[model samples]
Target: MLTTLSRIVKSGWLNFWRNRWLSSSAISIMGLTIFVTTSLLLINVLTNSLVQILRDKIDISVYFNLETTEEQILETRKSLIDLEEVESVEYVSQEEALEKFEEKHQDNQLLMQSIQELDDNPLEASLNIKAGTASQYEQIVDFLNGSQYKEIIDKINYRQNQAVIARLSSITAVLQRSGVVVSIILALMAVLITFNTIRLAIYSSREEINVMKLVGAGHWHIRGPFIVEGAFYGLVAAVIVLIIFYPVLWLLSPKMTAFLPGSDLFYFFRINFWQILLLQIAVGVSLGVASSLVAIRRYLRD
Candidate 1:
């Protein structure tokens, strides 16, 4: 088994380097496929991150009545937290809410003067509720309405902002689905291109392959080398992708962060480095080996 494996691998390696121009052309095509695939993956990642940042910013702010006690708000928070669909329920004291509102309007001299004249905080204490999904906001609102603390509740913005939330959620869903469709179509195109390339390579070797069969070489003995060659194309492409991915990200990230502060794409890439590498390798290797096998079999049949 070891001897046969070594021979197969050796033949594959030789085929790759011996036909240096052909090998380079094959690798270049394979690299294009990898480049497209990786580009799609990165776009998806950035889209998801941006959408999530937007969604997290938009949440249900449940306000308590002016007379509502701190204890009552804390109690409501506990109830919100117990729900399975709730991601988080953050409590903001009335004073803190007032401070935030003022800070936002501080640059408006008229607004600052008006607030100073009021001599009292008009903002109510609140629980900012985020659910596992936008669809679950209604359930959270219902829970708040039915809770024992409902009497102290002032208002929940879920009703007023529902339309905006629904529209954003729909947009996000459409984008995600579109990305998957595009990725799949490109992947199929890549596979076909690779299959045709390997098929041509096999056709070029048909004369040698026929002589081997007459000398009593088995099907696998002829087939194995081509498969290995395909895999090597994938391996080299994957390596090239890795070589270029990080530096490209390093260059692009600062620009992206400048466009969207706290997007932190560089940190995100580092955090998910292993996952990204594995995904690219899986795509490259699978495309390369599968296309090669299919091409060689078709060639043998012909």
Candidate 2:
């Protein structure tokens, strides 16, 4: 069994190396496919990061009435925290709010003097509510409005931020759907291309295959070499693509980071090195092996 397997591998390696131009053509196409698919995956990650940054910036601030006690506000905050949709709720006392306001307008002398003249803190204590997703904010606002403690709430700012949150929600939904559709279409195209390439290689070796069949070579003996050749193509292609990605990402990372702050392409690549490597290998090998199987099955049928 070991001897037969070694011969199969040797034959496959020779088959790959013997047809240099054809093998190169196959490898190039496979590499391009892997590169594009991997790129799309990175883009999806970057987009999600940007969306999270925006989501972080957006939250509904619920202000309490002056008569509302700290204990009451704490209870309301606890209730908000219990909601499944709520990611977090932060409580800011009136004094903290006043301090933030003053710091924000400190450069303006008139505003500073006006705020200091007030005998009591005009700023209200508030609960800053962050939801799991932009769409969930509306539900949270609804919950707050209908809660038994609603009378103590001075205002919920969701109405003012509704348009922005709605737009973000729409964008997120569209991106997710579009990413899946694009990924499927690209994968199908890659498989077809690889299958055709393998079929061509088989065609070039038709006479050899016929001679082997005439000698009563078993199906495994006949098919094993081609499968090995296909897997070799995938391995080489994955290596070439990974090498190409290093310089490309290094060059693009700074620019991408500049455009989208925290979305550093190279940094992401480095952090996810093993995952990306495995993913590319998995995709490439699966495409190559599956395509080879289908292509050879057709020839065998004939």
Candidate 3:
């Protein structure tokens, strides 16, 4: 068994080396396909990160009446935290709110003077409620509108930001679906191109194949080399992609960081280097082997 496997591998390598030019095109295309696949994976990661950042920014700010007490606000926060849809409920005291307002308007002298002139803090205590998902915001707002808390509650800001949240949800869904679809389409194109290249290889080696069949060689013995050749294409392409990715990501990292401030593409690549390499190799080799198997089917039937 081991000898047969070695022979198949050796023959596959010979075939690959013999038709290096043909293999070159296949490898190039396979590399491009893998590159695109990696790009899409990274893009999806970035999209999810951006989405989470947006989600973190958004939350239901329930401002309480100026007369509302700390105890009442704490009770309301506890109630909100108990709800299944609510992820968290953070209570902001009036003093904290006043401090934040002043810090935000410190550059504005008129606003600074107006705040100093006030006898007491006019800022209201508020509860910032974050939900598990965008759709849950409405339910949370409804919960806050309950009669028990209605008198002390000044207003819920969810309604004001409802449209923006809804749009964000829609956009996220669309982007995820679109990424999957585009990946599949590109993969299929890679397979088809590799299949055709392998078919041409089989055609070029037809005379040798016939001689092997005349000697009563088994079907797998005949097909194994082609399969190995396909895998070689994938393997080489994966390596090329891995090498190309390093420089590309290194260059883009600083630029992307400049544009998005906190985004570090190079750092992300470095952290996931091994995982990315494995994924690229797996995808490249699978596409190659699958394409070769399908391509040689017609010839093998004889």
User: Which candidate achieves the best lDDT against the true structure?
Assistant: 2
Best by TM-score: 2
- Which ten residues in a row are the worst by lDDT in model 1? 293-302
Candidate 3, residue 60: the lDDT equals 79
Task: Look at candidate 2 and give me any clashing residue pairs.
Answer: none
Give lDDT for model 3. 0.85
The residue-by-residue lDDT of candidate 1 on 1-302, one tens digit each, is 89998999999899988988888777778887888888887778777877787778779898899999999889888877989989998899989998899889989999889888996788899999998877788888888899787899988998899998888777777877888899899977876787788778778888888887789888888888888888888888878887888898899999998876668677877998888778777777777788877777755663
Model 3 lDDT per residue over 111-165, tens place: 9999999998999999998888777898888877864998999989888999988
- Candidate 1: Cα lDDT at 276: 74
lDDT of each: 0.83, 0.87, 0.85
lDDT of 2 by residue, 83-143 (tens): 9999999999999999899889989999899888989889999999999988999899889
Which stretches in model 3 have alpha-carbon errors above 4 Å?
none
Candidate 3 is scored at a TM of 0.92
Q: Rank the candidates by TM-score, best first.
A: 2, 3, 1
Model 1: how far is 194 from its true place, Å?
Answer: 1.6
